[model samples]
Target: AELSRLLVLKPEILLLDEPTNHLDLPAIIWLENFLRTTKCTIILVSHDIEFLDKNITRIFDISQNTINDFKGNYSKYIIFREKEIERQIRQKKNQDRYIKQTNMLIDKFRYKKNKASFAQTLIKRLEKMEKIEIDAFDISSINFQFPPPLHCGKIIFQSKMLKKTFGENIVFHDLDLDIYNGDRIAFVGKNGCGKTTLTRIINGELECEGYFKKGEKVIINYFAQNQNELLDPNMTIIEYIESIPTEKSVSQLRGLLGSFLFSGDSIYKNIKVLSGGEKAR
Candidate 1:
């Protein structure tokens, strides 16, 4: 809907940041087609490699307080960047060697009256030469791993004759399903196709006429679409996180929060004033 509104204005330039976050596959494909066909220049910030490769002609990479421009897609930009870094490293080594030779010449001839002119000339040359400074390159890797799952029965969830409705509007009827352990399932359909409704019914958030049972030791962790709405507006970020039961010390908790990109005074920020992305974090 927002994309449609933006297109109606027919702007010459478009700026998008993480545009695919909540988009379905079909919607994403449609967006790709629309952007590819438009004459408008687009500047987008996305971590989606496939999307960038398909739509973008150029890349502006920001690193170490500098913007490096590349005349190609994401993959090509990466290759170009690596080669550029190697060239810069070689140039810096050569510059260092020239400066060292100039210093040596100045030091060895400074006292000799005949070579004093040569020493002064070298000093002037050294003073006028521009020194090359290398930017700090960060190659730190993040620690990312999922926790082990708890023990559970063979059957995770079993449902029969599941019927969910909101007043006279039926979401789904006579839905029978048996989800087993280690099973991977995806519910995909157009909007208002009972996906969310079915999940809500399964989670017991909404009442439905059905036979639903969970296996022994079954645990459910439900993440709502509007999860940010559930945050307490009165609580500061740190205070809110600390409310949860944990064995971690205060410093450990802060470290954990920093890993999530919440650091310094931002931890004291009230949940009410945080942006959508921040609150979602």
Candidate 2:
């Protein structure tokens, strides 16, 4: 409902600051889908690297009191920045030609007999000129491992001419995409570019015209933005979770709930009647 409200405002540019900070998993993904389908100019500041990479196409970086603009998604920014630093280094290496030429002219003219003070001053000025400054580049980096890929049957799914619109806003047009079992796909672009829209059309519920297809026995399950409702109004916080069948051991579940700020009798409170902070809990 909040997202639908935002969509009604007809903004040409959107600014998001840690927009996912308080969102549950489903809400986070719903935002992801919503942003993916949006075609507005968006500027986002987020600590969520995966979300940033999946959504934003440009990076504006401020470092050491200087600002740098990179015309690519976050992942490409890393690759392009490394290459750019090397290019700048090469250009600066050739700048020695300026100093060497100046020195040569000084050597040739300095010994002229009875040279004036003005000439001496000129030589001194040339010698004192500082080298152009181009600072060395530094890029912070981290490496992590992902879960092993699960194999799916070939011809995973297909969609024909999916469509979406919000009043006058048209999110997609005649879109077609096919997924295969072994494909490891990464959607790259700025936020609100339809990555999430396509996900919705594939799963059904989002409106579409042309036929969509999927290989046999494909399973689809998503925790949409409304997963917060799972907190349950009628049940106590602990009772809400206890009602669900979970594979987690009891100790692990308690630890997880504690992380979300529910512990002891606090979990025993009826969530439907809980305060905002407690529901957030």
Candidate 3:
């Protein structure tokens, strides 16, 4: 609604932050078209690479305490940034090698009376050379994998004539489902289409009219769509992960969080201070 209002006003300059956060597919598509054709100069901050690639003509990359402008979309910017980093790395390596060789020459000849002047010249040249500094790249990625489920019956879940309603609105009705041990399922629909509601019901987090049954030794590890909202705001990342009932020790837990790119002092940061992406992770 806020985005709709902003678009209606047709402001000369539009600034948006994570505009596709909770938008459905259709809404995201419409927004992409609108932004592509809009006359306004837009400054958008989004982690949605596809959205940015579709709508943006330029990129402003904030890194190393600087804002670097690139003259293309997200994909192009990635290519260009990588090339730039490679160039910087090469230059730094060459410069370091030169500096090292020059220092060695200076040290070897500085004590000799005949080469004192040459050593002094080398020192002066080294002092005058500009040092190359490369920006730090964080390439850490999540590495944890889900453990294999314990042995269970082939029929994992079964439901018959499942129905859900809210007041006068019937979200879904007369639905039958059977989930097998190795079956992979995806529930896709537009906003408020009961996908989440159905999942919640299956997880026993919500009441529903249904004949539902779990197979022997079945276990459900549910991650809600609004999982970030369920986080304890005052708890640190490490504290929150530790609160879960697990046999992993502090060091192992830290390694797990590190795999999720939460390293160093970031593991100690309160959940309230984390960004949306960090919270989601």
Candidate 4:
């Protein structure tokens, strides 16, 4: 609704932050098209790389206390940023080597009266030299991987004549679904189109007019779209993770959390204090 209002105004400049947060796939597609065709100058901040790639012509990357401008889309910016980082690394290495060599030369002649003047000259030049600084980048890979589920029958889930309704509004009706072991599936639809409703029904979180059965040893771990809301606000990140029935030790768990970019004291932060992204993580 807020986005709709913003679009209705047709401002000369549009500034959007995470505009696709609760938007459905179709709505996101529509937004992409609108952005592409709009004549307004837009400054968009989003984590949706695909959306940015399609809608944006330029990028203003804010990092390391600086804003760097890139002359293309997000995909192009990624490549350009990497090459730029590599160049900076090489330059810093060369500069470090030169500084080290100069220091050594100065030390070698500093005590000698004959070359004291030369040492002073070198010292002045070295003092005047600008030091190169490389931006710190975290290259740590995310180490999150679900543990393999216990062996189950081939038919993981089966549903027949499924129907769901909210009061008098029919969400979906006469739907049949079969989910087998090793089958990857995605449910996509417009907002309020029963995608999440169907998922909830399948997860046994909602009462539906349907025949649903789970195969033997079938364990469903549901991560809802609003999963963060289900978290215990009083619990710290480490405490919440520890509550899960896992065989991992404290150090191992800490390492796992670190892989998710929650290192050091961050794991001790209460869930209530975390940002949406951090809570999701």
Q: Which has the greatest TM-score?
A: 3
Local accuracy of candidate 3 as per-residue lDDT tens digits, 1-281: 88999999989999999888778889888988898888899999998898888889999887656778889899998888799889999999999999999999999999999999999999999989888988665445688888888999999989999999999899999999999999999987788998889898878788888798888999999887689999999999999999999999999999999888899999999999998889988
lDDT of 1 by residue, 56-89 (tens): 9998887667887779999998787778778888
Screening candidate 2 with a backbone cut-off below 3 angstroms (N, C-alpha, C), the clashing residue pairs are 35-192, 36-194, 55-190, 55-191, 57-190, 233-272
TM-score of each: 0.79, 0.40, 0.93, 0.92
- Candidate 4 residue lDDT tens string, 1-281: 88999999999999998899889977888898899899999998898898888888898877656777878999998888788789999999999999899899999999999999999999999899888877554345567788788999999999999888889999988888899999999888788898889888878899989798989998888889999999999999999999999899999999889889899988999999998888989
TM-score of 4: 0.92
lDDT of 4 at 154: 97
lDDT (Cα) of model 4: 0.89
Query: Each candidate: how many clashes?
Result: 0, 6, 0, 0
lDDT for position 82 in model 3: 91
lDDT of each: 0.86, 0.71, 0.90, 0.89
- Worst lDDT window (10 residues) for model 4? 134-143
Question: What local lDDT score does residue 251 receive in model 3, on the 0 to 100 scale?
Answer: 98
Q: In angstroms, what RMSD does candidate 3 have relative to the true structure?
A: 1.7
